[model samples]
Target: MNRRNFIQLLGVGAGATILSSTLIGCGGEPHVELFGWSGPAATLKDIRLKVLSYAILAPNPHNKQPWIVKLVGPSSFALYVDPNRLLPATDPYYRQVHIGQGTFLEIASIAASALGYKANIHYFPEGQYGNKALANKPVALLELTEAPNVKPDPLFDHLLNRHSNKRSYDRTSLSPNEEQLLQTFHQKTSDAELVFKSSAQDQTQLTGFLTEAMAIETGNKARDEETIAMFRVNQAEVEKYRDGFGVAQAGMSGVKKIVAETFFLSREKLEKNPAGFGEQAVDITHAAAESTATFAWLTTKSNQRIDQIKIGRDYCRINLQTTAMGLAQHPMSQILQEYDDMLPLQKSFKEGYGIVPNDTVQMLFRLGRAKPTTHSPRRTLDSIISV
Candidate 1:
């Protein structure tokens, strides 16, 4: 049967019926409240919420926005991990989640600086925990204090524009000076080592590792389901969830988005059988990796919870710095994931790069020029507040 007939017949049942409207609705570029970023300065209200307004926009894995804020005082709040918002299948160690906590904290600090306040973040306030385990401890105890002389962070200006660009790059490398600027742009808040692999041979090998890693990642049913659960199939889903990613975030637009959503994309199909989706993901990963000419990763000497969070802060700054330089950056973290299936490739990748055996590679991503992709949506501030 043709796609139309198949869809109509499937519509008779519950699962396929919902796709009718969502399929066509995906074509329009509706104004989503989540994508419209009005930073803390616009509200001028509660200091906690004001700082949080921008903090919610921090780059996170799968756009999960896995953070919980509890109001501790008039000017203070505590950040916790929303255990529900974790990638257990892909990120078994909760390392990425803690990293996400770090990014959130970084953005909150920057927002406070821009708003004439200093955000003092005390890590693991209730006490630290093991990186391999999740605990009831607070990730950070943040206090917002008035500081009339606070200097706004330069990266703060790029907050609204910084995004994880996923489109194929222009196949170019950064100049030696550009690389030096990145190498030297260390902030006092973080001490992670930032390493780059942009030489012709390094790029080729890293690209192969990236593509193979993705192939391994999508080869599992549970892993594919974990990812598809967070995938917004259309614009309606985007509006309904106000989080997660969609074709638009993949840099699909004009005819590309319409074609995918109309003919190929369907949530029901992906949910029922993810093998096809997995294959497509691998293909896309290969294409994206093959076209890129530069790769970078962050490493830390230890794998403590504090170390992961600190690395996250540094990654956030690099993302913002690259944005300021008109460079597009996208994180390809499949090889770095801590899942069982990915460990072998992970080991080989680390050894091949001559990286320290004990050091943790916190983040691995590509950097080059590409058109801006859609900004991943963020949930409402109310969604992340602890009652």
Candidate 2:
């Protein structure tokens, strides 16, 4: 269906659903709230749009921007996936999209907490309905809760600052105490398993395997194509249009530039031997693996969608904790994407820890002490939520 029809079906008043709810300050306020009025006096009708504004900023897989919020009442909201945003080729079963929704619920909950409220999330509250529902997937629902303590996460203060740093991380190991702190962050969350390896030799082996994985990733025609598609080649493009799985640095802009320039400067030649481009891609990936201090795998007990979202939220929280502890985290999901040869990868991963096969790896990251990097751009709250 068209965007307009879809909006209408969601009861968003057709074309008017994209409306922005900006909160105006009366006396002296530096920043204007998106939902017009603020303060406790405002009822749910007065603030539903405001609540959704924060939810829109939640991150999604591949920047597919797959979520659309339907404000059901003053204190209730529904989270739906925009099927048009699905990555059928890469995520054939829409598992990633569901995980994205989990991230959405987390964001909504956090945002609500910031506003002195809590969200009561009910996944698939109703039976399947239209394309909004994934194949046999239940409708996800969330209700707002009034709580005494709605204090935002201290880490939430760094939401804008938090980003996935893909650059070469500094070679530094976490101290025993620091390692314990990271472990604590995972221990609180029951859904995920944090696998930490400290041995320099073990890290080196994992790094080498990751390098090989990168080589294989670039060599595969389909995988390379997906990577190329997500590369936002330049600053101007990124600033103007914000949404892509990855951003390419100006000078070392990887296959992204090769692809973009192909359309602009060398379209014909690129259409020939795309495999030749894989060389630099491989090196870049390997460099990413080589320049890190430690390697960790965030695995889930089961491969359920809820578990994936839990993994995302847990990882995001841990990343902030890492930042606060004067460390850096760069996700190395490339190796885990090697679904075919994951046996050896799993074997190697299990060599250090007695992890089981039932546990699915959600994200792989390298952590160390590194200089803080620039923040990546995000979609405006205006473009995100609906009331």
Flag regions of model 1 displaced more than 4 Å: 1-38, 41-44, 187-189
Using lDDT as the measure, the top candidate is 1
* Model 2: how far residue 234 lies from native, Å: 2.1
**What range of 10 consecutive residues in model 2 has the weakest lDDT sum?**
9-18
Model 1 lDDT tens row, 247-316? 6765676554665677777899889879877877776777777778888889899999999888888899
TM-score of each: 0.90, 0.74
Q: Best candidate, TM-score-wise?
A: 1
TM-score of 2: 0.74
Residue-pair clashes per prediction, in order, are 0, 11
